[model samples]
Target: MSTPTSTAAGTGQFSQRRGIRLGYQMPNFSHAASPRALFGSVIAQARAAEAAGFDAAFVMDHFYQLPGIGAATEPMLEAYTALGALATATERIQLSTLVTGNTYRNPAMLAKTVTTLDVISGGRAVLGIGAGWFELEHDAYGYEFGTFTQRFERLEEALQIIQPMLRGEHPSFEGEWYRTREALNEPRVRDDLPIMLGGGGERKTFALAARFADHLNIICNASDIPRKLDALHQRCAEIGRDPKTLETSFLVFGFIDADGDRARGLQRDLIERTEVEPQLDRHFVGDPDDVAEQIQRRVLDHGIDGVIVNMVGNGHEPGALESAGKALGPLVHRG
Candidate 1:
């Protein structure tokens, strides 16, 4: 349950040890899952994760589902509102979005919302920020989905403005996408509210995370891990920072099954559902022991400090979650 530490630059920010931080992605786009079911399921999942010893829980922030998912305007809950409800429901696990878009809300307001949620949750909130993606959702909702470069630029600016405000200062900023006066945020509940940036952008995003984020999330081809991590180190060095200061988190799209045949079948079904080729090399699947071993191997092999086992929505049925949580006990609890 406790976060283990490792030497940073050969100096200890934490003890020289690290452990897997188990996290579950609460399904927002799951076709078989509804808002009411999601709310209840999230509550249950959090409790289950806590009892099973997960480190945190996160939800998706989107008005609609990804294109392939049959439903167009499916039931979805706003991220911060659901977070407030989640705060009231859970006791210990940290809460956050997989990554809330900078385009969705004003940076100042989003920062304030997270700080408030952190306070309500007694400092267990993580603000995961990112450049908005999924053009369909933006276009349909009447929001401009600009070029990729523009979004990243906006995301960087948002972090620069919002982090300081959350840290108790009036932030003044002017940017191409967003502008703000010297605005002060009141009742800054949690001084250490962690600002996490998600993406695999090697240039701007990774560098910005090195400079600003408490944590960095890696979401990309599993083969890209070593190269991206190397880039992260380079960025930290460029910023005159110790690379070890930032926590590394990976998002895996996979499953866990006890029976080998059943595991392969589930994986096949998942691939069919998503219409995307399943990359077993990039995923964790098989029995509890097999999955656990894969996770541990990923940690040591990929230089990953923690992992967020993306249940991939309905792909993770009841028994699957149980297997993952129970089997992962060793790696998650290891120190």
Candidate 2:
């Protein structure tokens, strides 16, 4: 098992690769569902996703819905709290945020929170973190929204403390953005809880992933996948780490429906509503077959480790999760 997760295992750097697996991100608490039913809707979608053969499920870690998805006032649940509840609701599917914004919490507290999640979920937690990018959230919540360089620096310090703690070791580090005095995460469920680092910063992110992360989920223009993979490989090699040991995946925006026409219609409406040009490079808009084929050709063929798709439209509706999985599950498993 590639560390049995993207977050755990070993002393220095990750040394193994988990086989490719599929995942879904439930990102629709603010759209079709009533405000009162937000968390329930999230739980239901997560349950449906697991039943439909998704290997993992995720939600965004943010105080506000992202600009393209909804307004800031849209219902956005706290990530760990929702995941803690999901632990009781699920038996097999891995649970995590697509990527946790590091600035939202203190590094030590974040490590402890993830450790608690690991214990609660029976070792089903993954630390998917990134140099937080949502400036609006930071400004809104009174977090120090620093420059890009500063955020990456903070993230590096965070991992120094977080990774060792995940492995049941206490680490002390003092840096410009953070300082830890022998901080530790106790009662760790497992020493090797996989750590996944998300984003596509070629210099900062890939290097950090090489040194600290077991998985790297690339978030970028779809046309950039191959180049990004090459860059990641180089980052691993530069640090004398094996590239294969760092599993990889891409975030796909999927607009799925019963048929192509319906899917495209939904897609067009979303485009009109958002008033933004569609980013269809790694995105899929069609029936199961269309989505699956695009995933196979664009993602797997590029040697990505996995595919994590987000059904942007109609995901909360009945039969959507199962039907989409029926088409995409085979491809995800084959990876």
Candidate 3:
């Protein structure tokens, strides 16, 4: 098997120049007034992020809304379809799902889908993927939800097939879980479309990222970052790959408002509504300055390469993402 070329410099112009230091994630669509207004709201936020200097824009790839964010019946857009439309709607910001579940599509088909997105986006597509989780979605959508080890095994095999196809090579592989015979991917805007793995499993996820992903978006709580980074470094060492070659970022659930009190209130409401313990390490709820300070202290200071914030509470409101961008852009893009 041929080693896939490095995509560290091929995510897009923004990534090559600034390396995804600041990203906006749109995780909830319920804020849209009605079904007809959904895509418009998404476009508005994407444009705002681009205008506010965000390096990338992300959406969740799920058939149903995530548990903590909203009810399952709430609006959830198909990730690739949304991204394809976003490609025409915005100009600069890179577009992708925060992490695409590998179980949702076949490896070869997934390769072709993202390659099409890359061509449509004019080289601004990123293949952010992970081993499938969310058994509820799988059950509801009729995708097989296997045991934990099985899912990881499938992911490993899928990558074996995906990596070469992403590089325009026809790879033939026969694995217990998946098989591809000289699968072809043509019409790709660039061969090295970046693949970002999102998760914080110290063993499996990190090791796979070291071997296959150009970036690793750490998705665990903030307190776990140091340990996760250490694990990721160890994984790289095990494979004789430099840890520095894998760019890293942390996921933050933010609730930003100009008024600090209002931001706190919003956070409280979410906690009350979801009836779950607030994982403070993964959340930043405050005024712009407050959120930025928390991110700098908790995320950037830990040596993570970037921050991807999902402001589900108010991100759809006018100026919400802009305010976040204004505060976070400078912190992540320092000299």
Best candidate per lDDT, number?
3
Give the range where candidate 1 is weakest over 10 consecutive residues by summed lDDT: 6-15
lDDT of 3: 0.86
Name the lDDT value of residue 47 in candidate 2: 91
Stronger candidate by TM-score (2 vs 3): 3
| Cα-based lDDT at residue 151, candidate 2 | 91
lDDT of 2: 0.82
In candidate 2, residue 276 scores what lDDT? 49
Q: What are the per-residue Cα lDDT tens digits for candidate 3 across 1-335?
A: 33333222222211232367788899889887799989999999999999999999999989998778777888999999999999999998998888999999998899999899989989999989999899999999899999999899888888888787887778887778877777878988777788889998999999889888888899999988898999999998997887877899999999899999999898887877774566777989889999999999988899899899888788888988888889998987778
Which prediction has more favorable lDDT, 2 or 3? 3
lDDT of 1 at 301: 66
lDDT values for all models? 0.72, 0.82, 0.86
TM values, all candidates:
0.87, 0.93, 0.94
Alpha carbon lDDT at 146, candidate 3: 93
Q: What is the lDDT of residue 220 in candidate 1?
A: 73
Clashing pairs in 3: none
